[model samples]
Target: MAAVIFLVAAAAGGGSAVWFGAQGWGKAANQSPPVLPPATAEVTRQTLTATSEYDGELGYGVATTTTNRLTGTITGLPDVGDVIKRGQSLYSVDGDPVILLYGELPAYRTLKEGDEGPDVEQLERNLEELGYDGFTVDDEFTWRTAAAVEEWQDDLGLAETGTVELGRVAFLPESRRIDGLEVELGAAATPGQPVLSHTSTAKAVTVQLEPSDLADVKTGAEVEVELPDGKRVPAKITELSTEVQAGSGQQEEASTVVIAVAELSGDKAIEAAAGYDQAAVDLIVTTGERKDVLTVPVTALLALAEGGYGLEVVAGGTTSYVKVDTGLFADGRVEVSGAGIDEGTVVGIPE
Candidate 1:
């Protein structure tokens, strides 16, 4: 006669614990005929990818505020969406242009013949880029560099003092599109006052995730962005930053968040996002993948009482347990390999 076998079914990848009590017949001298399993599934081979999706905004990315270091009335302001490049007039103060230069260091002091520092070198680089040459682009600001600056000032109709005065120029890392004007045309332009806000012209997706969610994400990681029109485009993370957000109420606690900026890489993304300036999108990042491997539903795995894990192979009206080794677990399927476990092998599943 058949006898009952108690089995503990634990899903792979730390799934919940399940206990199953069933009747079974084994091929032995005194055992009865075999009993069929209630349910069965076949082992199959396919690629599986583990991914996480987050809400993102598709736009020109973050905006940086351009503060005024000059003192005068705001005579001219660029219209919103105006792109300012190197050697161009970003805005005007008292009818004089505050030139835009490409550099990382801000103009902190007046750069003259005797000043020697990184800011001087930055100015010299911009002067050389604007076609005013003859001076070495170094940390030292010599008379020759002042001569080039005089020439540049002459072109902009400024005083030919041969000394670059503070507040005469604004330094940015690159060309930027005007995002918004902070002050009106007639507003007073005082030192340290914000003038306008700008951003890069390239299309990007911005995602804010919890700090713990950023463990697998890094700069230069490739990801897919799903646009509003159901188009998928490839992108790469270009920047990452962390910020602490203060709580609004006393009962709330402050939280740290990671900001991820991903720039769109190909023409497909540009074309798909042509009509919209900003839209909601989804950022999909793949964390793990496995290709061409035998897999089974996680529920099919049985925790053996002896040790390790096993699967009940159902064949020809009889069932036998085959111990198997497991690998990556993804999408409710576990990568499995062992003796007698091949593609099309029917494995028993709990009803």
Candidate 2:
């Protein structure tokens, strides 16, 4: 015998309205008005996913403004979308190339053969990476380091000063794809002036999630990106930023937005979104998923009088009541489990 998760307590003896509370059934004699027929549903197994979709922007990533450090006329600028690599000119100032180097520490001062600091180490590390040899990679710049600098300078057509001064090179964490330009050619470029903005070449989708959605948005969760062409691409949550921005509306209150990054992985995703740039897409976040679970139409649920819930399990001509616990509720079907219920158990529904 299956234990009933009675939503309402069944009476010991037949009484006026036999059913007790929210979801209990009346005594079989009073269950139906002669006109309405009984309806039934099969209890079966299937997979389910609890998810939601939101509008998202598809692109490389957020653009970071690239600022200049040395004052000069902006003689040359890379075309938007140019992929700048090491030894290449990021932008020319007074016709001298501010060579691109891969590093995180920004150059803060004029570096010479005698300087010693983390900046020097960054410069030396880049020099070695650029194929300049004979200089041990270290913070202390030696004579060999100066020689390497001179060779690099000659290659870029600059005076071989054998020293790196602020503004002669730009250090980024890695290669970058120029996303946009902020200044025009021949514009006066001053220290700390905005030059341009860029992002990684890889494709990603960004979402500005509302506060309520944060609970379902987790790093590493799988998501589906619906492209503008109506095609779907698989992606994963790569990053999340909890940022607070002040509102400019009449209320003038601050609001926190969860900024998420969904990276499109695999060759298929790349091929699908290869031609797109700054396009709108749909992001389906799968908060939860379940498979092979017992489920029935939501209508089968009866709020029990005692607090839980009960399923009106119909057997033969009479309805046998059974208590049940609920699980995932999706697509008008809900998960349920209780004693006595089987894959083919029939449950009752209102007419």
Candidate 3:
């Protein structure tokens, strides 16, 4: 009976194996292992430097505005945005003959050195009537001009500055004229006032500094000014007035300061604006820098078995895990300090 039972059990086990083989399970077990896909990686480097960057705008160095001395109608003046030179004739007062007055002027009236018109004779006659000598009514302010100015000042009870103050002559400042027609010919002007505008534009820049950043800046700080044409101009902080000016954003409680910079390299555009341009300005102030550090991509690190972090290194088609220490991060890279990993070592990426 025991022999018969053993034969039956062997026959049952054989039948079961035949059924499973016909189902393809046996053939699948004998198939070759699966091949992994290719992985991308980067080699480690010993020397790595990190940098921070900022973006801003380009602007003019200086800009000047003009106002009128006497309130008059706009007349006999160049149009706006016109370039002018020193001593250019801007406008005339009325059709009336001009009178020149100065506390420092000679008592005898004489034509200026550049005067060559018929008015020169009239000037000489006027000077002689004032009882000044050295001029034969020749219409010129000569050395006798100095004596005449002293006499004039004495008569007016005013101190002489060795220069004439032409207050009465249709009364325009010599060597400079109105830049543009600020008022009309019939406009009335008061004594000792500005009728035309003038600007030097020598060394100027329009700098916009954050009021909150005042702690990092002051007058005389180094600055770099860029022009619209990609020109980089060197400048130094000159004025740091706390006064806020009009800008794109207007906040009653919020505040900002306008900084003025002077070009140290003597830029022509800056000099013209007198160190104050209407264009925008950009400023670069470095906060810090770091260099020569080991770094890696943030994606390469993996959790290790012993509660540490590691990366997988591939060599000879075999993957070996490596443990590493990490440090600072800048941009997309993180600084790492590790052992058994030399520069240019290719690390494997996990599947």
Q: Which candidate leads the pack in lDDT?
A: 1
Which window of ten consecutive residues has the lowest lDDT sum in model 2? 13-22
Instruction: Please report how far candidate 3 places residue 241 from its true position, in Å.
Output: 2.5
lDDT of 3 at 278: 46
Superior candidate under TM-score, 2 versus 3: 2
1-351: candidate 2 lDDT, tens digit per residue: 112323223533332111432233544685662221268899998997787999999998777778898887999999988999887888989998788898888777899989998889999888888888888888899899999999988888999999888888888888889999999999998999999898877799989998789789889988899999999989989888889999999888998989888989789998999989789999998877789999989988776555566777766555656668889988899899987777999888864
Candidate rank order under lDDT = 1, 2, 3
C-alpha TM-score for every candidate? 0.85, 0.83, 0.38
lDDT score, candidate 3: 0.46
* Residue-wise C-alpha lDDT for candidate 3, range 37-155, written one tens digit per residue: 24536645544443322233333233333333333343345454444442233443433222332122323333345444434544445456556657556545555655665565555
**C-alpha lDDT (0 to 100) for residue 325 of candidate 3:** 76
Better of 1 and 2 by lDDT: 1
Q: Give candidates' CA RMSD values in order.
A: 4.8, 4.6, 18.8
- Summing lDDT over every window of 10 consecutive residues in candidate 1, give the lowest-scoring window: 13-22
